[model samples]
Target: MKLATISVGGRPTPAVALGSGRFVDLSREGGLPSTLLGLVRGWDAHRGAVERLVAAGTAEIGPEGVRVLAPIPRPERNIMCVGKNYYDHAHEFHGSGFDSSGGAQAVPEVPVIFTKAPSAVIGPGEPIPAWRDPTGTLDYEVELAVVIGRGGSGISKADAYGHVFGYTILNDATARALQRKHQQWFLGKSIDGFCPMGPAIVTADEIPDVAAMRVSTRVNGELRQDARVADLIFDIPTLIETISALVTLEPGDIIATGTPAGVGLGFDPPKYLKPGDVVTLEITGLGTLENPVGGRPA
Candidate 1:
């Protein structure tokens, strides 16, 4: 089932998409929804009930009736992001000269991980702020995000999929120059309004064949990034196992599976996002996440 957090009648509510640009308000009257994080916290004890609601078609809201928010609007923690997981993307980034890891060919034996502060996240169709850094370069990485269901450590690849609650689209909007300057990803990647996520989080039950999906990004209506999730060098299970062996993976933790090639940095002249440009990131089944670039606030 596709689950979402939306504002209806002045309060946030849990919702299930009704698929024609509509949703079923799952909240009680005059109340805010248990945030997506809240729901996932109780997932083990509540999955059956949620599935029942969707099965019964007990929906009560439509698109015009509510304002949608990121499925997990305020993440309880920093988002776990994977870097250089796609081969061509690694080479493209390396060729861009912003890469400090020697080159993308230095594909790691393990996942290259980083985190984006939760405050950076914005909902679908939100404006991606230029962030008051005119000299900074902005780029987009369209990724398939995995929302963890049951929290645990030392998870194995064989059982990794079992811990997934659902999936969603995320735009890893990046400021390229600061990344190279800081010599670390956090400063350049963690800028506010940099992480654009959600349309809805489609539960794992709905997406059985997850990895074969395609991920792509478009800027100003031009396709920029495109690749199959199957192309991931390390794959999901390996990542989960690797990360969990270190720190615990908890519910609501988002693992951005990484982006494919075709980023602006991949171009010979390096095309960057400018004000008034519209960027769209799409992943199979998760839906399209589109945002307009707005100049820094005067």
Candidate 2:
């Protein structure tokens, strides 16, 4: 089932997608957690109930009736991110002169991990703070982020899939100059409203073969990035195993599994984002996450 968090009567509420751009307001039902994070933390115990509710649900809101927010609007912590996990993107970034992760190896021997501040997250249709970038070199990285359902340390790659709750699209918006100047990703990638996520989180069960799913990004009307999950150099299992070995991943923790080639930095002159540009990211069943470039929030 596709799970989501949406605005209902001005409140962020847990919901189940009924498709055709409609949702069942799960908030009205008692005994369920109030927030998407709470629901996910108790997912195993609440899964059966949520499933039944969806099965019997009648669509309560249409796409035009309410606003869709990020699946987990405020993740409990910074989002864990993998850098240069795609072969072509690795080569493109390495050659682009923005990569400062050290070494001449375009593709790393292990997952290149970093974290984006939780405050950076914004939901669908929200404006990306392109003006706040300071460096004026805004760029977009469309990624597939895994939502952890079960939390544990030292998880084996073999047991990784079992720990995933669902999937969502994440735009790892970056300030290219800041990224290179800082010599690390966190500062450049963590500007407020830099991360645009959601539309919905399609549960793991709904996605039969994740490797077959494709992810892409379009700036305005031009396609910029396109690749399949199978193109991932580290893959999901390896990422989980690699990160979990050091930090204890918790329920609702998000791991943005890097982006494919075609980022602006890959271009000769670099096609950075302007104030009026629109970025649209889509991943098969996860739906589209589109955001516009604009000045600071009012």
Candidate 3:
């Protein structure tokens, strides 16, 4: 089932998509969880509620007066992001020289990990505000975001997929100049509204096999990045097992599984984002997440 958080009557409501830009307010269902975070925290118990709501065709509403919010509007903590997890992107990032990889362009033996502040995430259709820094040089990384449903540590790669609840599309927007200056990614990547995610989150049942999916991004009307999710050097299960080995993965915790080659910096002279540019990121099972560039003084 496709799930979302939306605004209705000035209140945030957990929802299930009813197709054709419409949604059913799961919040109104007696005993149902009130938010996406709440639902995920008790996903095992509430999965049946969401499925029943969709199957019953109840509380259907159109998008006209509603605002679709990120599935997890405010994450419990920072977003777990895998950096340079794709072979071509690893080389391109190394070649760009802004990479914190010490100019290393080879595929990593383990996943290159980074954390993007949860505050950076904005819902689909929101503007990706430009940074005030000179060289603005903003870029986009289209990724498949994994949302964990159960809490666990020491999870094995064989059991990783079982811990996942669903997936969403995410755009890891960055300030290339800041990336090089800070010598680390947090500041450059955590700028407010830099992570544009969701139209909706498709449950794992809808996508029993994720590796076969395709991930692609477009700037305005032009295609900028494209790759198969199967190409991930450190695939989802490995990523989960790797991260869980250190920190416990909890319900609603998100992990952006890195981008493929063809980010703005992968171009000759680097085709960075400009005000008014619209970027759209799409993954096969998850819907498209599109955001327009916002005007910011250079």
Candidate 4:
């Protein structure tokens, strides 16, 4: 079932979608019993609770126009992102020093990972702050993001799928020059309002094929990046197993698989984001996330 976090009458609450464009407040049934992270931490046990709520006709479905919030706003940790996991993307940055060949290099033996601060996350429909940096080089990376359903450590590649709760969309906004200046990715990636995610979280059961989804990005109605998850060199299962070996994968933790070719940075002139620009990230099964660019709050 499709689940969402919404604000009705100023109070943020959890909701489940019912047919005919209606939604029910899961909180009405004893209020989720715990935090969203808590629900994910004990997903195996709470799965039935969410299912029963849906089955019992307790959720209220409303018009699609209703305001939707980020499914898990203020997650406990920063979001994890993998870079250059697609062959074409690997080749595009091959000799750029970020890739093995700087532009013609071979794929690495493992996934190259990075993190976006939790402060950078913005919910669906929220505005993305335009960086004050005068360089004018903001770019977008559309990627398929995996949400961890259960917490675990040292998860094996063979058993990784069991740890996934579902999927969502992520727009990895970047400051290309800053990335180059520090020889690091975090600074360029961690600006506030850079990570735009969610319309809702699709439960794992709803998505049977994570590897075959179509992922794309559109800037102000123009298609920018388009590719399929099948192109991922390091798929979901391997990503989970690999990261878990280093740290515990907690519930609500989001892992953004790398973007495919066609980022603005890959272009000859390199287009970048500017004030008033709108970006939309869409994944086949997951819903779309849209954000408009603007300068920092005055």
Q: Which candidate is the best by TM-score?
A: 2
Candidate 4: 10-residue stretch with minimal lDDT? 96-105
TM-score of each: 0.94, 0.97, 0.96, 0.91
lDDT of 1 by residue, 74-183 (tens): 89889999998899887777667788754346566678899999999998878889754455588889999999998899999999999888999988888988888888
Ranking by TM-score: 2, 3, 1, 4
- What ranges in model 3 sit over 4 Å off? 103-105, 132-134
- Model 2: per-residue Cα lDDT over 1-298, one tens digit each: 8888999768899998887878888887789999999998998888887877777765467877688898888888999999999999999999998899999999999899999999999999999989898889999999999999999999999999999999999999999999999899999999988999998888899999999999999999899999999999999999999999999999999999999999998998899998989999999988889999997666
Q: Pick the candidate with the highest lDDT.
A: 2
In the predicted model 1, the residue pairs found to clash are none
lDDT of 3 by residue, 139-243 (tens): 999999999988799999999999998999988899988888989888888988888889888888899679999999999889988899999999999999999
Question: What order do you get sorting by lDDT, best first?
Answer: 2, 3, 1, 4
What is the C-alpha local distance difference test score of candidate 4?
Answer: 0.80
lDDT per residue, candidate 4, 1-298, as tens digits? 6766777776677777554547777777763643455666776766787888777875565765567777777778989999889888777766444442133446767888889998888788888777654566788899888889877999998899888888878888888777777777898888877788787778888998887799998888999888889999999999999899999988889999999888878877776888898898899988788989887676
Cα deviation in Å at residue 220, candidate 3?
1.0
What is the model-wide C-alpha lDDT for candidate 2?
0.92
At residue 128, give the lDDT of candidate 3: 85
- Listing every candidate in turn, what is its Cα RMSD in Å to the true structure after a full C-alpha superposition? 2.0, 1.3, 1.6, 2.4
